[model samples]
Target: MHIIKYLRSLQIRPNFVKKISLIQARHLQTDVFETTKVKYKYPPVYDPYGPRPPPSEKVTQLADQIMALTAEERAQIGSALREVLKHPKLEKISTEGLDLSGPAAGDAAQAEEKKEEKTAFDVKLEKFDAAAKIKVIKEVRALTNLGLKEAKDLVEKAPAILKQGVTKEEAAVIIEKIKAAGGTAAME
Candidate 1:
């Protein structure tokens, strides 16, 4: 508003006051009488079919709420959860589908440290010659520790993960071995 007055004192030709008033009036009208806009039918939009439905407003709101939490808030929430779970009555609710006696509470830090030092891998067979199927199957068996029949079946299914959660070194060795046996393998 002060800028508008300054412009007026500078004798700017265009009337800023009128433009500002017009914009304000339009905004007010749209805000107050916008129910008609909402009531108007929208054209049908065809999206490619998928298994999962679109996220609801509540899910979006929940996601926003979670994302907006500070680290301190998250820590506080975690402590609150721990306190709640300590209750004997709440143990059943919290431990549902989880092995309550599996690990000690003292191992939580060790588990977190292990999570930070992630060690996992995947072996994907991209392509392989039909003639080398037998050799590829043998390598898959050795790498995956699968039965002969299962390994053969896995090798036949190209572009599939051969193994997962191995060390990266083991994954590389497996990929190299498969490639040497005339099969195209990828470490993922």
Candidate 2:
């Protein structure tokens, strides 16, 4: 009837239009119509919800403070932050070869070893008579400019040189220190 005419005006399909109109008519009631009435009103354009949590009060304050700083101040603050974040662990080093013990014991042992070596050399030199030894020492001192102790050392070594039949020139060369030191020898 009127529903078909309205459906035709709207250009709806005939079968669907007839079914929808019949359903609407069956469900329609005066009280139900009153209860389902919707008064149209504009929804709010701007939400009243508070700001997001990421840009919280503390973060906003910090950002504002950072933005307000001069270049030098900002650099100083950045350097300070880097220093705070850069904590390094200290390593414990083992000093096995460092030998923290005092040198007294080592010095004593070295001194004793030197004394033993000197005693051995003295025993070997005992084979030569005092006059031969003195004569050898004077010759060595005349040529080498060596002190008494060094001259004695040369004398102690003379037996070996004599065994090899070292020439006067060779002996003179060996005792060059005595000549430099202004010593004289009757033999030379």
Query: Against the true structure, whose TM-score is highest?
Result: 1
Question: Ten-residue segment with the worst summed lDDT in candidate 1?
Answer: 87-96
* RMSD in Å for model 2: 41.0
Write the residue-wise lDDT of candidate 2 on 73-181 in tens digits. Answer: 9888866876789856446899986748766865987756655322111111113455455665665555457798976775665433311234555544544533333
Query: What TM-score do all the candidates reach, one by one?
Result: 0.37, 0.18
Which candidate gets the maximum lDDT versus the true structure? 1
Looking at model 2, the pairs that clash are: 143-175, 143-178, 143-179, 144-175, 144-176, 144-177, 144-178, 145-177, 145-178
Q: How accurate is candidate 2 locally (lDDT)?
A: 0.57
Query: For each candidate, what is the lDDT?
Result: 0.80, 0.57
- TM-score between candidate 1 and the true structure: 0.37
